[model samples]
Target: MNKLLFIALCAASGTTCAQTPATNPMPDGSRDMYVGLGVQSAPRWDGTGSRKVSALPVLQVQWSNGLFISGMSAGMHLSTDPVIEYGPLLAVQPGRDASGTGRSADGVGTYGPSLIGPVPEPLAKFDARPTRLDGMDKIGTRLTGGVFANYYVTPQWRLTSSLLYGAGNDHDGARLDLGVQRLAVDLGGQHHVSLSAGVAVANRNYNQTYFGVTAAEAARSRFTRYDAGGGLQDAHVGVRWNWAWSPSWMLTSNVQAKRLLGSADKSPLAERSTNLTVSTAIAYRF
Candidate 1:
């Protein structure tokens, strides 16, 4: 539930962050703040290939000194040139969901092992925890720190790239993402529309940790042993619309489509190669 406060922040595509007003009481320069009510639809876990859309709250803050905090990430902006801004970042990883296998929304598969009537027992010997019908593993939320750079080709068109490395048992790996984005602001001072496309690359340990299956697991779960060596994990494109409904409020909505790539798509745990997620929100801009 706490992830709510940071979802859109993590989804930051170098979105425009309003600066705080200099007149604010704090000795620090003015900082910008925002609060919004929204619904976020996303994959239940990194490789589950399942989607969930639920109520959420979104928050954003940008300090006057080029420091910013959003969804899963926090960073200090090192440079803010007309075309380039780079920074060091620290973020929380949204590890696997506690709910393992079942036919319900929580299951690894839509119907867990029952769909295939497989062995469905004893998750993994090395896992050291009681196995669930879903044959899935629990990954704790972890910290990933890295660097992010944004390049603006034009005032409205930009490129973003980031590399993240896990700091502990939570991830034990690394991931890289590159994004191309286009967005227009101040459309008559009332409308904003944005488009984004991206690709993500993951390492072998990163993919295996989530999508791979072991002989011990295959024997009990009835799933063939799979070793996923990651390369390109997924690709996605999205469109978003935002309208200033009033001086104090804005309305927003977006739809995103993504497809699994490479070995990640070959895993038995993946039921679909593609998925769609949509969300909308209203926020008070201050």
Candidate 2:
């Protein structure tokens, strides 16, 4: 039941988005791994109109004991059933700063070297820019804990869900992601593509941390005070293409589009409600 297909899927989707790899059954001590590098073009932040290009690091590994690492998440499978998969998960949530530059967990090291460090300070604190988040408090990177479960409707289709907490500065943020994946679709030769669509829901704390603005912040920043409530956050769709040129070498790529909804979309920080992220890399199977 080795699900190699998810390797490319996770790589393209920003591994920190929180996903559980399919169960991989192997010899008592064997493992599977993939590592590579690529580039991604994505919005500076969740709702900003600005976009930036960053380096993407691809890494997915699963051991026979069920422990696995995919992008910025690590978890262990607890089920042996082919039709159902469950596991405890841990992930890193990227932080946000006044510069409107953050989101490190999009992929392993995709957001530059600021991954584990404190969010950078805004350089233009006195330059009242219309789009800058200056005067806002910096949100540091957080480690979230949760679980994931997936049910196979058939060999080619599956439903996926994961819940995680401990996001945001207060560490009270929580989020749930629900989605479905259409496994590999043969395109002849050694090429295949997978499709996925999903929606995210978050608690008030989670939404507020990213989208809300306090009175204190409003006094300094350009945005007025806003209190974001809990509800649907975003909807997304993605496609992954994998071309296995050889048994050990393959070209993997992904394109994902996401749109903010509810309070998140209406936030003053949201210069745009919709955005797209794209990445591609060449990986080696070991």
Candidate 3:
């Protein structure tokens, strides 16, 4: 899967090599909408496993007046164990043990030698079970939408930023992206290629309680509730290539590298690792 994604990225970059910038015709007065489909994968960040694949569908609408909106949705089946570990001490109580052993339910079992007595029963039935926790095997979809504003820094340079919100069946988050794109213009008066790069940060929340603890009798032995809070999601760097195929049509390809940062593990559905993503699309302007 990684190989295939790499191949697609290569093709996109290779196409850029053939483009020779031309003069912008609709330069500052055009509106366009693009819809495309592609493939995506979330690979293990620790470098010890296989990559998972998914389907990606995206839509983007833009205007020369600097207003734009875009949306993307993808689905994947992935897994991870975001476990927090604690101590290994056993808990016992004094007096209740009948042998006068100095022990407590707070897990101070090694403070003294074991004494022959009836073990103090746990205050809570589930206290006998293990604590600390992690999550694994996540299958879900992620949907993202955003509005952007662009400013023309120069006839050939533009800066853009957007506020984005993302939601999933099992995952939800918000993101912000800031970037610049430049259209290289040659003397021929035809726009042939463009280059863009950006940085994005996101925050996501996971439904850990749904998968963490159980209230059912059959699951009582395997469940323990753990708090999973959201945090800085992922940071990414991306580049795109625009190839004008004709007067009103073009093919655009994008490649991005994403790194899971900060407390990403707090979200059970997050891969909580770094990955590289590449995609492509073809659009037309009227």
Candidate 4:
């Protein structure tokens, strides 16, 4: 009877040992660090008449433990137009010219001028002046960078948070986003494409700097700067395609769209400025 009890105990211990969880493998095989360069452009609908272009250089560093940091620097330019005016109107001309009429003997006649008294009072005042307005043709630059970390609660899931800053032209603002990323499974092998989806909330400061207005100039023009007051930004969902052209190089294309959910303008022109960006890049992973 003692022998039978010993055998049962041995069997239970073996089952428990077999149920132990397996340790997760590190990401990829080698150290994960990548550098990339690309160009991005968006069609301008801000009444600027010129298309905008951005030259972007990207850098990313990743660890085997799912932590990563990435950054991008971009120089942007808006095109110039000869006919578009950006400033306030300076002068105006009336529709009709009244000084070309000739005088005749009749007191009143069609297409003819009438005689005037010694102290003649003009029938109407004419303004034949030309109008002009201010224009914005200055070049602007933008710099943006952010750091993010991912924690893999499971082999296919991660939670992420990032902080971003944007400066230049009308894009001086900061953003904070917290979301989750998931790797979807495919029937293909490990080399198959991976898909990720997430949502983020952002806050923006729409000060005079965004309007191309200086503090002193704003005061003089009596233009009130728009304060967005930490409103709800936009939600985002994106997909990335990772193509391995060789062992050490990969190409990725990412497209994202963010719509402004709250008001962002204090001027007529600013009210028309919204943004959309699409980018593709090739990276060398080390």
Best-matching candidate per TM-score: 2
Q: lDDT tens digits, residues 1-286, model 4?
A: 1100000000000000000001123455433455776654432322111234555444544343333333321111111221111111110101111111011010000000001113222112211111110232232333344433334566554454444455334454554444444443333422323333333333444222233344444454333333434444433344434455666665654433333334332332232223333445666766
Q: In candidate 4, what residue range of length 10 has the lowest lDDT sum?
A: 8-17
Question: Candidate 3, 178: how far from true, in Å?
Answer: 4.2
Candidate numbers, best lDDT first, in rank order: 2, 1, 3, 4
Q: lDDT of all predictions, in order shown?
A: 0.53, 0.72, 0.32, 0.30
**What would the per-residue lDDT of candidate 3 be over residues 67-172, giving only the tens digit for each residue?**
3333321111111111111111111111111111111110000000111223233224233222212232222333344443345566556554444444323335
For 1-286, candidate 1 gives per-residue lDDT tens digits of 1111111111421111111111112236877666677776655543344445577555556676777655345677777464676878766665453453111111000000001112123224324322232554555556677887777687566676777888224456777777766644445767766666777778888777667777776776645799999698777666656676776677766665666678887876555566555567777767
The parts of candidate 1 lying over 4 Å away from their true place are 1-28, 46-50, 98-133, 167-170, 185-188
Ranking by TM-score: 2, 1, 4, 3
* Residue 193 local lDDT, model 1: 62
* Model 3, residue pairs in steric clash: 22-190, 23-189, 23-190
TM-score quality measure for candidate 3: 0.44
What's each prediction's TM-score? 0.75, 0.88, 0.44, 0.47
Residues 180-228 of candidate 2: C-alpha lDDT, one tens digit per residue: 8777788987888777777888999999988899999989878879999
**Per-prediction backbone clash count:** 7, 0, 3, 2
Candidate 1 scores a C-alpha RMSD against the true structure in Å of 9.7
Model 1 lowest lDDT segment of ten: 106-115
